[model samples]
Target: MMRRQFFLLPLMINALMACLAMALTNITTDQHALLAFKSQLKLDPSHILSKNWSVSFPTGKWIGVTCSPRHQRVSALDVSGMRLSGNLPSQLGNLSFLASLNLSSNSFHGQLPKELAQLHRLRYLDFRLNGLTGDIPFWLGLLVELRFLNLRNNSFTGTIPSSITNMSKLQVLDLSNNPLQGNIPEAVGSLFNFYP
Candidate 1:
C-alpha cells in the first residue's frame, strides 16, 4: 500500500498543478477580455473604470465587475450612470459567464452590439437612459435565462421584436419612452410578470 501511494503521489501533485494553472489561465482570459472591453469606451470623464480595471492583477474586485465563486470568471458588470459615451463593444461577449450587465444611464449610442447575443447565461440586463438607436435585435430572444429586461429610455426605433416573447423567464420588460412603433406583440402579455 505504501509503495502504491508513493507512486501515485507525483501524479496527484501534477494534476493539482495542472488545475491551478488552468485556474490562472481562466483568470487571465477574463482579464484580457475585460481590458479589451475597457478599450471600447470612447469616454470616461471620471475615469471610474478606465483606471480601475487594471492588467496588473486579476479583476474580480474591480469597481463594477464581479466574478463567480467557483471559477472566478467575470459574471457581472454594473457601471450604470457613468456617463460613458460610445458603442458597446463586441469583445464584451467574451464574458461567457456574465449573468448581469448594467450600463444604464450612459451615452452609448448606435445599435446594440450583435455579439452580445452570445451571452446565453444573461439573467438581468439594463440599458435605460442611453442614446442607442436602431431596432431591438430579435436575437435577444436567444437569452432564455433573462429575468429582468430594461430598455426604458433609449432612442431605439422599429417595432419591439416579437421574438422577445421567447424569454419566458423574463419578469420585467420595460421599453418605455423610445421611438418604437407598431403594436405590442400579442404574446408579450403572456409573460406572467410583465408590466406595461
Candidate 2:
C-alpha cells in the first residue's frame, strides 16, 4: 500500500501543477484584454481607469472590476456614470467569464462590436444613455443567458430584431427613445417580465 501511494504522489502533483498553469494563463489573458480596452478609451474624464487599471496592480483589484471567487476570473464590470467617452473595443469580448456589464450614462459611441456575441455567459448588459448608433446587432440573441438588456436613449436605428425573442431568460428590455421602425415583435410579449 505504501509503495502504490508513493507512486501516485508525483503524478498527482504534476496534474495539479498543470491545472495551476492553465489558470494562470487565463488570468493573464484577461489582463491583456483589459489593457487593450483601456488603450482605446479616448477620454477618461475622472482618470479612474487610467490610474487604476494598470500592470502595477492586479486586474481583479482594479476599480469597477469584479472577480469571481470560485473561478478567480473577471465576472462583472460596472463603469456606469463615469462620463468616459470612447468607442467600445472588441477586446472586451475576451472576458469569457463576464456575467454583468454596465456602461450606462457614458459618452461611448459607435456600433456594438459583433465580437461581443462571444460572451455566452453574459446576463445583464446596460448601455443606456450613450451615443451608440447603427442597427442593434441581431447576434445579441445568441447570448442565451441574457436577462436584462438596456439600450435606451441611444441613436440606434432600424427595427428591433425579432431574434431578440430567442433570449428565453430575458426579463427587461429597454429600447425606448431610439429611432426604431416597425412594431415590437409579438413574441416579445411572451416574455413574462418584459418591459417595453
lDDT of each: 0.89, 0.92
**Candidate 1, residues 1-196: lDDT per residue as tens digits?**
9999999999999999999998788777778777876788899999988778887556877989999998679999999988888878787887889999999999999988888999999999999999999999999999999999999899999998999999999988899999999999999999875666
lDDT of 1: 0.89
Best by TM-score: 2
The C-alpha TM-scores of every prediction are 0.87, 0.90
RMSD of each: 2.6, 2.1
Model 1 spans with C-alpha error above 4 angstroms: 1-22
Best by lDDT: 2
Q: Per-residue lDDT for 101-170 in model 2, tens only?
A: 9999999999999989999999999999999999999999899999999999999999999889999889
Q: After best superposition, candidate 2 residue 36: deviation in angstroms? A: 1.4
